[model samples]
Target: MRIVLATTLAVAFAVPAVAAAPARPARLGLCAACHGETGMAQIPGAPNLAGQQLDYLREALRQYRDGRRNVPLMRAAIGPVSEADLDALARWYSAQMPQTQGTP
Candidate 1:
């Protein structure tokens, strides 16, 4: 009984702390200028970020940050983003439903 009780208490305390921090909002203010308010793009060249694969987005950001992909504007945009922020942003957009082409 004591073991079960202790285990229950431990699990309860452990889970919430991990769950508490929200990975930025679905609409990020900085991303909004090009990626639109909801991961959709309003800019001419920016691709829609909504519903992209998490791994793909993360890799792209990593590339941009590491200079493997050399689009000057993207490198500039990602320069200030930390690895954690990049992961958060990737998760944020990956969970969104993709907008259909020409739907707007």
Candidate 2:
């Protein structure tokens, strides 16, 4: 009984502390200009990226970087980014909780 109680207490205390500090990509500010800090789109035509699949985000970033996607703004924004930075951006955006309602 004591062991179970102690284990539960440890997890309860530890989890919130870890969750409270959100990990973000270094270039999140750049994305946040169009995509909000929480991954919601701030600009009129920008798409929301929160809760997107990890694979899709990575692939999309790659396509944008490589100019296959063909949006000039996206190409410019992503062109100079390294592979590791792209992956980190993808992971960060994918991990965000998406909005529930249809419109922002």
Candidate 3:
């Protein structure tokens, strides 16, 4: 019966891990690809996000997430993020120093 006991323990431990696996940080890799690591986007047509107003940035993300603003790539990028993550990103980007002074 030792084998049965060990199997039961293994499953009991594994269930929590499996349930917790999906709690990863909201994936922002796509944003970096276009928007750059610091929000100074390099890809064509990607807007610079550094030092943007907090409210504006937050609103844009909210719109994209909810389909209120339908920029296909942006919608796709933010598609899986939660509202909390959107706020976090807005705060991060808004805190960046603008590439030029007297901006944002």
Candidate 4:
């Protein structure tokens, strides 16, 4: 009985941790078209997002979503994003390792 109780408790605690792990945003491919999959910018004039402050990334996404930023492409891409998905994107981009040019 004690073993059963312990196992149940362990599973209960483990479940939330598993669920809390960040998921890849559904719109990642769209973002990746401009910003590389690891947050490096692939196109000219696009800013690199990797290693940016978490709060900054999150806020920038929010601004783009709410129309404050005013860039047509960003506004279009961020328009249909849900709050959870936005947060997930921010987390993903912010957690990436940044690559610098001319570095071996």
lDDT of each: 0.82, 0.88, 0.77, 0.88
35 Cα displacement, candidate 1 (Å): 0.9
Off by over 4 Å in 1: 1-22, 25-27, 101-104
How many steric overlaps does candidate 2 have? 0
TM-score of each: 0.69, 0.78, 0.67, 0.74
lDDT of 2 by residue, 1-104 (tens): 99999999999999997786447889888899998988899989899999899899999999999888999999988778999899889988988889865745
Question: Over the stretch 20-96, how does candidate 1's per-residue lDDT look in tens digits?
Answer: 63476533676778997668898888899988898999999899989999999888777867877888888888877
By TM-score, is 1 or 2 better?
Answer: 2
Candidate 1 worst ten-residue window by lDDT: 20-29
Clashes per candidate, residues 3 or more apart or on different chains = 0, 0, 0, 0
Model 3, 60: alpha-carbon shift in Å? 0.5
Candidate 3 lDDT over residue span 1-104, tens digit each: 99999999999999986664322224556777887667788787888987899899889998999999978888888986788888778877776666752546
Q: Backbone clash tally for model 1?
A: 0
User: What's every prediction's RMSD, in angstroms?
Assistant: 7.2, 3.8, 12.5, 6.2
TM-score of 2: 0.78
With candidate 2 superimposed using the best TM-score fit, by how many Å does residue 6's alpha carbon deviate from the native? 11
- Model 1 has an lDDT value of 0.82
What is the RMSD of candidate 1?
7.2
